[model samples]
Target: MKIVVKIGGKNIDFKNEDYFRVLAQLVKEGIRLALVHGGGPQITKFLEKEGRESQFVEGLRVTPPQDMEITEMVLSGLLNKMLVGIFHRQGIPACGISGRDGFLLEGEKYYPASGDRKVDLGRVGEVKKVNPRLVHVLWEGGFLPVISPIAADREGESLNVNADWAAARLAVALQADKLFLFSDVPGVLRDVEDRDSLIEVLSWAEIEILKEEGKIRGGMIPKIEMAEEALRGGVKEVFIGEGKEMENLPLFLAGGKMRGTKVVL
Candidate 1:
């Protein structure tokens, strides 16, 4: 199976090797996997240490020109290599890469459309195209690709992209069978405070209604929005679930249910 998995920054706990172990097991079982990761928390920490306050516009970080350098270093340089090293320890031949590598992802500057107030998200980009050759070559050569979401603009400069959206575009380009965004939450919940209120499945219509009803807000808004784009872009399945639920991926693929929400068209 061809699958794209995304891991969020807040969920990057080295102590919890369960997610890594599960991914390794799947790869050993002959699954073609590509991992896209984000280091938002780490970026924030480093930015604050440099006296830059992290700001956001509609859940998307409002990066400044100065912050772009730091973002690229943390995402493409540090976190990307660290993840490749982890996969190496799992006995997997993994290659760390950025979207800028071979222009795998080329994008234009992004502008937020939701907010009533105008704000600038410097160095932020939305994907314009995806080149799948590098990823396919890595997979064919028995190497797992650990991707950092750093896009290149027309001027060949780096742009910080949301990892979830990167994974979505990559999934569409790869024509992946499944796409999973693993974050801290179990799934889309009716009540943010109640884990038991987790919604097992959501359709596009329902998601729109939920948005209007204000059930979904903050970071989750873009997560689901990207899932919708992937679904519309010809990906077979997409799931917004917790990383731990990935341990049950085999069963889920075998037609069993899991804890995370499955976003369907």
Candidate 2:
């Protein structure tokens, strides 16, 4: 089965051994997997080292020109290669690439407005188009495509794209059988402070209710929204679960069910 897996940047520091083992197993199973990753924490570290302060507007990083340069350096250069190295060490033939490579992803700039304040987040972009042919070619050639969230425009201007949105677009483009999003948390919890209150399955209607009741708030809301969008765009299924508990991935794929959340049509 073809799958698109999105790894969150926050989990990078955790060094989840299970995650790597699961990935190796997937490769051994001959599953066509495309990895999409975020490196916000790494970017933040770089910014901190450079004595640059980062501003966020509505939870989206407002990247200026210099910040964008650093972002490209970290996401494409540092984190992307790190993942590739991990896969290679596991004897999996993997190719690390940026959205700018072959113009796989192209997007327009986004300007978010908050009341009277209009923020100009330089280089921030939303995924507008995806060319999955590049990924398909790699997958057909027996190579996994590891993607970093950095797309370019028609004029070759690099833009910072949201990793979740990029993964959803790629999943739709590839007609992937499933989209897996790995997060630090277990899954969508009914109560923010209650770890045992994981929502195992959610239909569109159920998700709407959660949103209306404000049960789904903060970063999780966007993750769920992205998964919902992917489901609506024709991807067969989408799973959101813990990156640290990578052993559960195969179980989740095998219809064995997981403790995490599943968004289905």
Candidate 3:
């Protein structure tokens, strides 16, 4: 079974051996999967060390040109290779790559919506086209790809892309059987302030109502939107859950209990 998994940077931990073991086990079972990772925490830490200020707009990082180098370095270099190393320790042969390599994720600069004008998120991009050639080649060679969400525009300039958006795009392009979005939150909640209000199952119609009622807002909107897009794009299933619950992959694919909100069409 082919699956696409996107992990939030906050949830990534060197101590989190359970997560890597789960993924390695999946690979051992012959389940083809690719990992797309975010490195927000690492990037912020690096920026602070470099005396560069970090900015955000609408929950998305405002990556100025100066910060772009650090962002790419942290996301595509350090974190990506680190994850690959961890997987290697588990006996999983992982190939670390960024969206820029082989034009894996190609797009244009993204100017987020502002009140009247577009907010310039310098060096940020949207994934317009996905070239899965390299991914397929790696898969054929029995290598699991661990990707960093760094896209390139038409001019071959590197642009930071959100990991969730990147994973969803890759899932669609690969026609993956399942798409998993790992978030800091446990799941989609009825009340953002209440962890117990996790919505176990959700539908597109319900999503609209939730948005109208303001139950879903901020960063989660993009995640939910990506889930919906993945579903609409022919992905058989889209799952959003707490980052730690990534261990539930086997159970989830086996139709067992999973602790997350499953998005459906």
Model 3, global lDDT:
0.90
Give the clashing residue pairs of candidate 1, or none.
none
Tell me the tens digit of each residue's lDDT in model 1 across 35-120. Answer: 99988899999999999999876677888999999999999988888888788888988899999998899998998865586456
Q: Candidate 1, 257: how far from true, in Å?
A: 2.2
State the C-alpha lDDT per candidate.
Answer: 0.90, 0.85, 0.90
Model 2, span 1-265: residue lDDT tens: 9999998888775365546878888888999899999877789899999999877665567888888989999999999998888888888888999999887999889877768886689989988889888898898899989999999988999999878888989898888999988887888888889888888888888889988998987567668888988988899888888777667778877877666788876
Which window of 10 residues has the lowest lDDT sum in candidate 1? 111-120
Ranking by lDDT: 3, 1, 2
Q: Highest lDDT, which number? A: 3
Q: List the residue pairs that clash in candidate 2.
A: none
Report the alpha-carbon TM-score of model 2 versus the true structure.
0.93
TM-score for predicted model 3 compared with the true structure: 0.96
Global Cα lDDT for candidate 1: 0.90
Give per-residue lDDT, candidate 3, residue 135. Answer: 91
Superposed by TM-score, candidate 3 places the C-alpha of residue 217 at a distance from the truth, in angstroms, of: 2.8
